[model samples]
Target: MTRPLRLDALAYGGDYNPDQWPEEVWHEDVRLMREAGVNLVSLPVFSWPQLEVAPGVYDWAWLDRVIEVLWAGGIRIDLATATATPPAWLVRSHPEMLPSDSDGRRLEFGSRQAYCPSSPVWRANVARMARAMADRYGEHPAVVLWHVSNEYGDHVARCWCPESAAHFRRWLEDRYGDLDGLNEAWGVNVWGQRYTAWEQIEPPRRATGPVNPTQLLDFERFSSDALLELFRIEVDVLREVTPDLPVTTNFMSLLRDLDYWRFAEIEDLVTDDAYPDPADPRAHVPAALNYGLMRSLKGGRPWLLLEQAASAVSWRDVNVPKAPGRMRIDSLQAVAHGSDGAMFFQWRQARYGQEKFHSAMLGHRGEQSRTFRETAAFGRELQRLAPVKGTRVRSRVALVVDWDSWWGSSATESLPSQRLGWLAQARAWHAALHALGHAVDTVRATGPFHGYDLVVVPNLYIADAAQAAALEAFVASGGSVVVGPFSGVVDATEKVHPGGAPGPLRGLLGIEVDEPWPVPDGAAELVELDGERFDAPVWSEWIEASGEASVVARYATGVLAGRPAVTRRAHGAGVAWYVSAALAEGGLVAVMRRALADAGLPARTRIDPDVEAVTRADDETDYTFVLNHGAREVAVDVPEGAEDLLGGDATTGRLVLAPLGVAVLATPRAAEPPFVTLSETTD
Candidate 1:
C-alpha cells in the first residue's frame, strides 16, 4: 500500500474568497497574508454562482487571477470544487432537485448545501463542473490539494421526494438483499411494519406512525450512506483527472447527519471545520477530541484544521470575539492535538451575506485591523517552526468510533431520556482523552486493530459478529480495552443481540448485564474514585458477574445500590474495563487515566495538566509542542538546555508561559528520556 502524505510542519493560512471582492484588492490581500506567515489558502470555496452563471457556460477569469496572485506570493492553494451549492439557475430549472424536509415541505434554495444529494440532475451538474475545473487546473503548480465540497451535512437528512424515495428503496434492497431479510431486520412484525414489497418502505418520518425506532435508526444509516455515495461521485471525478493530488471534504466536528468515519476511509486526507465558543469552559476539549478523532480515522496521518474563525463567528445568536491571545492559543492547541495545518474559515471578511460579519484576519477595513496584526505575527511563528511539520505524533490509545452504533443508540425512541444520547457519550469520552493529552485515533472495528495499547468504545450499541470477534481477539492478545455503557446492546440489524446485554462484549468483559436501571431524569448517584467521591447520573445498567472481572466502582444509592458501575477483567497480558453507567466528567477522566497507565500508556509527566503538550517526530529530530490552555501564567520546567522555536531563547529550568501562550521546543534525539520514547509507542 502507498504511504499517506507527510506534511513538513503545521501548514498555516485559511479560506480565501477573493472572488467576492474586487480584482484591485487581491494584491493587498496576498501581501497581508504573506506578512501573517500564511502558507496555504483554500480558494474559490463558494464560487459556484460565479463559475457557472448560466447553464453550460463557464467563467474562469476571476478564479485564474486569484490563483496566480496567491501562488506568486508563495502560498499553496487547497482548491475547492466550487460546487458547494448549485447555481440559482439549476435550482429554478430543475425544481425536482430540491430536497423535501421530514414534514414534506420542499426546501428553498437560499442557504448553501440546499441541493438534494440523490438528485441525478444535481449530481450530473456537480460532476460536470468538477471535471471541468480539474481538467483546467489539475496540473497548476499552485494547486497542492483539492477540496471536493464544503461541510457536507446540510440537506443530508429528511429527503422524501420521489427521487429520494426511489433511491431509498434501492439502498434498502442493496443492504438487505431481499424483502424477507428486510422484514426480519427491521422487526416489521412488531407494529405491522412488515413489508411484502420493498416499495412499502419509506424514509422514516414523524407522519409514518410516529416511526418505529428500529426503522428510524435504519433510515439514518441509509441516509448517511446515500450522502456518502454522492460524495464518492464527486471524488471519483476529481481523482480521475488529478490522481496525484490529494482530495478531501471538510467535516463538521461531532456532526450527526453524516458518518465521518466512513468519509475518512474514502478521502485521501481528513479535514475538520471546528468553531468552539471561547466562553464555553469545555470549548478546548472538543477541538482536542476532534484532532484525536481525525488522527485516529486516518491512522496517524496528519489532518487539517480546515476552517476556524480567525476571531469570532457571526453565525451564532451572540457572536463573541475570542479574548486577547485566544486565537493564537487555540491554533497551537490544534497543532498540539495532531493537526498538520491550521487555517481559518476566511482570510478576509465578507462584504455581504450570512458570513459577512464573521471574524477574519483582514476585516472589511483591511490590514490596519488588530486581527490582521495578530494573524501575521502567528504566521511568522509557524514559518519559524516549519521544521516540525510532517513529524509524527504517536500514542498507544485508540477510540472505537462506530457510526452504526451511534445511530442505533441515539435513535432508540424508548431510551431513558433523549438527553442521554450517543453523541453526548462520545463527546464525553473524547473530552476525557483530551484532558490527559493522549494522542487518540477513532478507528473502525474493521480497520487494523494492532498497535494500540488501549482501545475505548463509548456507547457502542450496535455490533456485527466480525467486529465482536475482533474485539475479543484484541483483548486476548494483551491489548487493554474499555467498553462504555449501552454498548453491545444490538446487532447490525438494530435488533437486540439476544443472550444478554452487551451481548458480544459480555464474555470479554466477564459480566452479563441482567437489566438496565434507568436513573430518574433529574436524579444522580455518587461513586468513589481513588479517594474522593464523584456524582454521576443518567443511565445505569445492572450486571451480574459471570466470570473473573472485578467491580471497581459502585453506585452509592439506588434500588441496585452497591452494584458495579465500573468493572475490570484480565483477558491476557492486558485487561478490559466495562463502565456500566453515565459518569461525570471528573470520574470519567480518572477512570481512563488509570486504565491507560495500567496498560503502560500513561500521560506525559513533564507537561503540566493545564499545559497541553504533544511531540511530533521526523527522520532526525522531535519537536515538542507545549501550549497553555489556561488563563493565568504557568511556569514550565524544561530540560537543562533546549532551544525555543518562537523566541529563539535558550531555556533551562523555569519557563513562564503567559495566558493562552505556546512554546515549541526542540530536543536532540540522543538526549531524550526513555519514558517519553516508550510512551509514544506503547502499543
Candidate 2:
C-alpha cells in the first residue's frame, strides 16, 4: 500500500481526454489547465480501445504525446492503465467475455464495463494491456500514480453466465471446503434442498421461486471477491512492472456491491469518487460521512477525493447546477475532512458521448465561464495552503460501517422495512454528531475501537458473536455505545439469532425486543421525551427492560404507545443508549447531546448552526475549516491568534461567512490525547 510522492501543493485536476479532440485542442487544454492551477490530471481512463489497435499491437504514439505535453506543462499525471473498456473486436471474437444480469440477460459491449469478471480471456487481456502501459509510461517524469481499472463493478458486478457459475462453485469450494459445510452454512435443509456435489450448485439467477437468503448472501460476497480478484490481477501486473509506483482505484462509496474494506487492504490509498446530489438537503452529511469512512481506511490517514461534480452531472434525471461559490466551498470542504487532493470527473467538458453534458472545470464555453473562474480561484487558494498537507482528521466518535450488514439488509426483501438503508442510518447519527460539532469517524465494524469516546452501532442489522463481545467489552471499559433500532437482530450469516431480538447485546443494552414494529412508508408516530414530542419514523421495536435500564423516551401514539421508544442503561460504570426508532434531526441531536454528556464529553461549539467547523491537526498546527452551506451570511467565532490560511490574513472577533463561503484557519496545535483513552477502570 504505497502512496505517490508527497505533493508540495495540494493536487487539483480531473480526468483529461486529449484523444477525443483534435491535436490542435491539446495545446489550449494544457494552457487552460495551467491557468486554473491544476497540478494533476488523470489521463486515458477510457482509452483502452484507442491504445490497442487489434489484439497484441498497441499504438502508444498518441498516449506518449499526451503524456509529454502534460509533463511539459508542469502538470502531474495520474496515469491510468486504460483497461477499462475493451476493443469491440475482442468481444465479438469471444462473446463469453460479456457479463450477464441476474435474469441471465447478456450485457452488450455498447457501454463501458460489460466484461465478465470470471472470464480468463478478459483477465488476460486486461493484465496484458496494463503491463504494456506500465512498461511504457512507468518511467515518465510526469507520472505520479497509477489508477487501476476505472471503477470496478460499476455496471457488471454480478453475472449469471456459465463461466461465472463455474467461478462461483470454485469460490464456494474454497470457502466451505465441502458440500456438507456449504449445506450447513446455507441451511439448505430449509427447502429440502442440499447440494451433494459441486455440479449441483448454481449461481442464484432469476429462479422460478425465491432464492435462499443465505445463498444470496454468499453469492453477493463471492461476486465482490471476484471483482476484487480481477482488480488484483491488473494491480499485480502494474506492481511487477513498477514496484514503487502507487496504484489506486476510484471507489463509488454508495454502491453496495463492492466491499471496500477488503479492497482498501489492497488499493494503495482509499481514493473514492463522490458526487453529492444538489437536491438532497442532507447530502453534505452523507458526503462527509463517506469521506470520513474513506479516511478511516488508513487509520485516520488523509485520503484522496478522487472525483466529484464540478457543477452538475449527466446521470441524474434533473441535474441542478451548483450555485456560485458552491464549488470552492465543496472543494475546500474536501480538504477540511481529510483529502490531500480534490478532483472532478472531467477537467474539460466532453463534446460528445453520453456524458457530454456533464459539468467540468472548463465547460464547453471555456475559460471565460463562471465555473473556470471559481476553479482558478480555488486552485490558487489551495496553493497558498500547502502547510495544511499531511494533517489527519481526528474523531472522538466512531460509527461502525459494516458492508456485510449493508448487503444482507438491502438484498433481502424480508427485512422489516426496505427504507432502512445502511448508510442512511449511519449518516443520521453522523449528522447528529456534526450538528453537535463533534467530529466522527466511520470505520469498518470489524476494526478496533480503542480510542473513541462513543461507538455508534446504527442498525446492527447483522452482527457476530465476537463483534457483540467486543462491543460489550468497549462498554465495560467505560466507553459509551449507541445502539440504533433493530440492532443485533441477525447474526453474521443473515440468520435471526435464537434469543430474542437484539440477541446477545440484550445484556449490554439491558433491553429485550421480542419483535420489531415496522412503521409503514409515509407513516410516523410521536416519541415523548422530557415533555418534548418528536416524530419517530421508519421502525420501532417492542422493548422490555431486562436489566438496569431506564426509559428515556416512550412512544406516545401507536400500537406500542406508552412503551419505551428510547432507552438508556447504566452498565458497568458506563452507559448504553438505545434508539428504538428513527427520529427527526431535532430529536437525534437531543439524544446525541445526552449521550455525549453521559460519556463526560463537552458540549458542541458556540458557532452558528448553519456553518460547519471541522479541525484537522498535524504535530504543530490545527487547520480549522469553517464552511457556510446556508443561504445567508452567518457569524463564526474564530480562535484567537489564528491565521487565515485561505485569505492570507488573520482577525479575531465574529467572522462573518457569506452563503456558500469557506475559511481555513491555522493555529498553533496543542497536544491532544485520545478523547477517551482505554483503562481498566471506568471513568
Candidate 3:
C-alpha cells in the first residue's frame, strides 16, 4: 500500500479565499502572507457557487487569476474541489437533494453542506466538480495538495430523506445479506419488528417510545458509511484525474458523525480542524487527545491542523479571544502533538457572511489587528522550527478509541446511565494519563500492540470477541493493561453478551460483573485506595472476583461498601487492572500511576496543571517541547546538554517559561535514555 502524504518543510498558512475579496485586495492578501512567512493556503473551499455560476456554465477567469497570483508570490496551494456547498441553481432545480432531519422535514439550503449524502444529483455534481478542478490544476506548480471537500458531516451528518432511506436499505442488505440474517443481527423479533422484505426497512425515523437499540446502532453505522460513500465518490474522481497529487479532506477532530478510521484509511493524508474553546481552562487536555487520534489515524504519520481560530470564534455564545501568548502556544501544542504544522480556518476574516465575526489571520482592521501580529510572529517561529517537521512523537502508551463503542455507549436511549459517555470517559482517562506525563497514542481495540508497554481501555462498551482476544494477547505478551468501566458489555450486534458485563474479557480480567450500580444524581460515593479516600462518582459495578483477581480498591461509602471498585489480575507475565467505578480525577490518577509502575514506566514526580511537555525525535536528535499554559511564570528543568532552538542559546538546566511561553530543546539522541520504537504494523 502507498504511504500517507508528508510535507518537506513545516506547512504554515490558513484557508485563503481570494474570491471573498475584491480583485485588488487579492494582491494585499498575498503580500501579507509573505510577510508572515506563509507558504501554504487552502483556497476556494466554498466556491461552488462562484465557480459553477449556473448549471453547466463556468467562471474560471477569476480563479485562474487567484492561483496565478499565489504562484507568483511563491505560496503553495491546497486547492479545494470547490464542492463544499452546491450552487443555489442546483439546489433550486433539485430541491430533493436537500437533506432532512430525523423528523423527516426537508432542510433548506441557506447554509453550507446542506445537501443529502445519498442524493445522486449531489454526488454527480460534486464528482464533476472534482474532475474539473483536477483537470485544470493537477499539474499546476502552485498546487501541492488536492483538498477533497470541506469538513464532511459538519452540518448535515445524517439524512432521513427518502433517498437516504433507500441508500440505508441497500447498505443493510449488503451488510446482513437476506431477511433471516438481518432479523438475527437486529434481534427484530423482540417487538414484532422483524422484516419480511427489504422494502419494509427504512432509516430509523421518529418513533413513539425508545427505538430498537440495535436498529439505532445500525442506523448510526449506516449514516457514517453514507457520508464516507460521498467522500469516496469525490476521492475516486480526484485520484483518477490527478494520480500523482495527494488528496485529503479536513476532519472535525473526534467527530461522532463519521468513522474517521475508515475515512483515513482511504485518503492519502489526514488533517483536522480543531477549535478547543478558549473559555475552558482545561480545553487543551481534550485537544491533545484529539490531536493524538489524528496522528494515530494514519499510524503516527504527521497530519495538519487544517483549521483553528486565530482568536475568538463567532459560533460561541461568548466569543473569547486567545490571550496574548495563547495563540502561539496553541499552535506549538499541535506541533508538539505530531502535526506537521498549523493552519487556521480563513486567511482573512470574512467581511460579510455567517463566519464574518470569526477571528482569522487577518482581521477586519487587517495588519493592525492583534490577531495578525501574533499569528505573523507565530508564522516566523514556525519557520525557525522547520526542522521539527516529519519527526515522530514516541509514546510507550496506547489508548483504545473505538467508534462502535462510542456509538453504543452514547446511544440516546437504553443506556444504563447517560453520564457514562464514551468521550467523557476518554477525555477523563486521557487527562489523568496526560497529567502523569505519558505521551499517549490512540489505538483500535483489536490493536497491533507492538512497541508499547502499556495499553489503556478507557471504555469499550461494544467489545467483541476479537477485540477481547487481542487485549488478551497483548497482556499475555507481558504488556500491562488498564481497563475502565462499561467495557465488554455487548457484541457487534448490540446484543448483550451471553454473560453479564465485561463479557468477552471476563477471563482476561478475572471478574464477572453482577450488575451496573450507577450512583444516583446529586449523591456522593467514596472509595479507599492505598488507605486514602477519594471520590468515586457517576458509576460503580457489582463485580464478583473469580480466579485469583485481587481487589485493589473498595467502596468505602455508599450501599456497595467493601466491594471491589478496582481489581487487578495477573495474566501470563503481564497484569490486567479493572476500574469498576468512574473514579474522580484524583482517584483515576492513583489507579493510573499504579498501572504505570506495573508496566515498568516511571510516573513523573510532579505534574503541572498548566504545563505540557512533549518530545518529537528525528534520527540523531530529540526536540523537547515545553509549553506553559498557566497564567503564572514557572521554571522547568531542562535535559543536560540541550540547546534551546527558539532562543538560539545553549541551556543545561532551569529553563524559565513565562505564562504561555514555549521552548524547544534540541539534544543529541544518544544523550537521552534508550527509547522504545513504535512498530507501524498493527496486530
Candidate 4:
C-alpha cells in the first residue's frame, strides 16, 4: 500500500533554498513564510556542493541552523537528499561520471543532472549522500516528507558514454537472454544486422542512415529504465533508513523522456512539477489532463502540485507574466483536479543563477511584490478549504495513457506523418471531453477498467495481444470505447502484429486498415459525419469494414472519397467506436457525444470552451470547481442546495463569474462513487 503524505491541512509552499542566502536572511525568510501561511517547504534541492565541500567531508553547520530556525518558526520541511547534481570535486575526480551526448561530446558539470544515469560512480556517490541525509534528519520533528533526487531524466536522460554502453549491453542480456532471442526480437535479419555477440550491439548513436526501428525503441525503453534504476537506488536506501516518512521525487508532468507510470508505482507519494504557459489561453485544458493522470496514478488518490511558477517562467522565448487574477485561478484549477494544494518553484526569487529571472513566491521586491501578496491570499484560501484535503476525484471516463505507445509512435522518424503526435492527439480528445464537462481519469492500457463506463484510447500505437484482450473484456462487460487512429499497429518489439493495423482489435472495432493515407502538406481534406462536413487534417486512412460494423462517418474529399472514416460496432454488451482519421475539434466533440449517449451518459451541451467544471468528493460532500478561463464574464449553473466554500454563501441556479473567476461549490454527496479494484479485472 502507498503511504500518504503526513499533513494535517492542505500543503502550501515552494522550494526553499536557504543556502542561496546568508544566515542573517534566514530569519526574515521564515517570518515571511509564516505570514504567507506556508506550512511545507522543500529545502536544499541542489545543495550537494555546499553540503560536502570535499570528498567524504561534511559541513552541517549551515543546514542544521536553517532547519532549527524553520522548526522554531513552526514550518514543516520536505527535506531533499541534495543528490540532484554532482559536486565539482566529485565530477573533477571522476570524469567518467559525466554524461555524453549522442554526438560523442561529453557534457560538463555546470548544469543539474550532469552525471550519467548508468554511471556506477554516480550511483555509489548518490547512495552515500542519501544515507547521510537519512541518518541525520530522518526522524526530525519538522521533516514530514523525504524528497529524493530532483526531477529524474530532466537533463541527461540518455548518455552515449562507454559506461552507458556497457550498462545497455547488460540490460539487453537480462531481457533477451541469448543472441538468437535478441536477433528474433530485434528483427536483425533485415539489413544483415544480426549480432553475433553482445559486444556487437551498441547504443543507437549518430548513424549513417536510418537505424533499426526496434533498436531505437529498445534504447528509449533502456533510457527510461536507466533513470528509474537511479531513483530505485535512492528509494531503497531511504526506505531502509527512514521507513516511516513518505519518499517522492517530483515528476515532470507529461514528460516523454521518462515513463511516469512505472516510476509512480515505486513512490510512496506521487507529486508533479507543472508549469502551464500563461501565454496560451487554452493551456488549462491540457493541464487538467495532466493532473487527471497524476490523480489516477495511484487509483484516484490526491497528488501534490510540488512546483509551478509564481508568474511567468524564465525558460520560454518570450516569458509572459500571469495577468492580475490569473495566478489564483491557475492554482485553484489544480486543486479542482485533485491536487491537495499548490506550490511554486522557489520561495524567493534568485538574485543570481540560471533561474534568476524565474518568478517566485517572493519576487525580487521581497514581501512588497504582487506575487507574495497573491500567494498570501491563496494561502488563506487553502486554509478555508481545509475540508477538501483528502477527498479524491471519482471519474467514470478513463483515458488510456501508454508510455510504450507514446514512445514507439514518435521515437523513429519513419512514421507515416509527424503531424499527428501523441500529445496532440491526446490533447484534442481531452479538450473535447473537457468541453463536455466530464471529469476524465487516466488508465494504463493494461489496467482494470471496472470503475469506468467509457474508455477513450486516444492513440495506442504500440499494443500486444494482452492489451487488446483487456479492451475486449472492457467492452464485453457493458462498457463503451473510442479508439483514435494509427493504433494496434506494432507490438512491444516494434514489429508489426501478425495482421495489419487494429491487429487484435479488428474483431472488436470491426474494421481493417487497408493503408494509412497521410494528407499532403498544404492540402485541404474533409470528412462528413451525419451530413455535416468537418475539416480533417494531417491524417486519413483507407478503412474497410470486416465485421458487423456500422459506418458512422466517411471521407468526403481526396483519393479516399466515400471511404469509412469512422466505424462503430456492438461487441457483447457494449459498443466500440474507431476513428481512422484525425478529425477536427467539432467532429471529435460530435463523435464523443454519440459515444456518451451510447453509454447512457449525458454530454454537457453548453460547450463553453474556456469554462471548466470538475467535481471531487468523498462520502458526504461534493466539491464542484467552476473556473472561467475566458476574457469575458460567464454564468455557471450550480448544483441545488450547494454552498460556496470560498465566498461562504448559498447559491443555486446560475452563478455569474467574471473573467478569470473561480468558485468552489460544496453540496451533499449524491451516491457512492465507483472505485477501481485492481484484482477485479483481468488483463
Q: Which candidate number has the best lDDT?
A: 4
Query: How many pairs of residues collide in each model?
Result: 7, 0, 2, 0
Candidate 3 per-residue C-alpha lDDT over 1-683 given as tens digits, one digit per residue, 9 for 90 to 100: 44444356789899998887899999999999999988899989999889888888889999999999999999999999988888899999999999999999999978899899999999999998899888888888889898987989889898999999999889988998888999999888787888998999988888888888888888889999988988999889977887878889999999987999999999877899999998898888899999989989988888889999999999988999998888888899999999999999879999898999999999899999999999998898788888888888877899999999998777658878887788889999999988887778999999988888999999999988889899999999999999999898999899889977898999899998999988888886899999998887799889988768999999998788999889999999999999999988999899999999999986766766577777888998888888788887777666656787898888656677788888888887753332222123222
Candidate 4 lDDT over residue span 1-683, tens digit each: 57768889999999999988888999999999999999999989999999999998999889999999999999899999999999999999999999999988999978788899999999999999999999999989999998989988888889999999999999999999999999999998888999999999899999988889898988999999999999999999999998888989999888999989899999988899999899999999999999999998888889999999999899999999998888899889889899998889999999999999999999999989999999998898789888888998867898999989998888888888888899999989998988887878999887689788899999999988788899999999999999999999988998887778988788789999989999888885899998999888889989998658999999999899998999999999999999998988999998998998998776776577788877889889888888889998877656656788988988755677789988888888876332111121122
Query: lDDT score of model 1?
Result: 0.78
Q: lDDT scores for all predictions? A: 0.78, 0.82, 0.87, 0.89
**Clashing residue pairs found in predicted model 4:** none
Off by over 4 Å in 1: 1-10, 155-158, 529-531, 603-609, 669-683
Query: Which regions in candidate 3 have their CA more than 4 angstroms from the true location?
Result: 1-7, 670-683
Lowest summed-lDDT stretch of 10 residues in model 2? 674-683
RMSD of 1: 3.6
List RMSD in Å for every model shown.
3.6, 4.2, 4.0, 4.6
Candidate 1 lDDT over 1-683, as tens digits, reads: 22343334467888888878789989988887778878888978788889888987888888888888888998888889988888899899999999988777788988878777789999898899899899989999888888987888754555877788889889888888999988887787886777888778777765644567777787787788878888898889988898888888898876787888788888888888889897675577666767777776677877778888878898778888888788888887777666777899788898889988899988766777778888888887777767766666756677887877777777756664665677778778866776666656677865477878888888788876687788888888888888888788878776777785788777788888888776787898777666666667787778877559888888777776777888999987778899987888888888888887878775544333456667776767667777777877766555546688887987764567787778777777543221221122221
Q: Give the 10-residue window scoring lowest on summed lDDT in candidate 3.
A: 674-683
- Position 501, candidate 3: lDDT: 86
TM-score list, all predictions: 0.94, 0.95, 0.97, 0.98
lDDT: which is higher, 2 or 4? 4
Tens digits of per-residue lDDT for model 2 on 331-375? 887888899978998998999999999999988889887788888
Q: Over 4 Å off in model 4, which ranges? A: 672-683
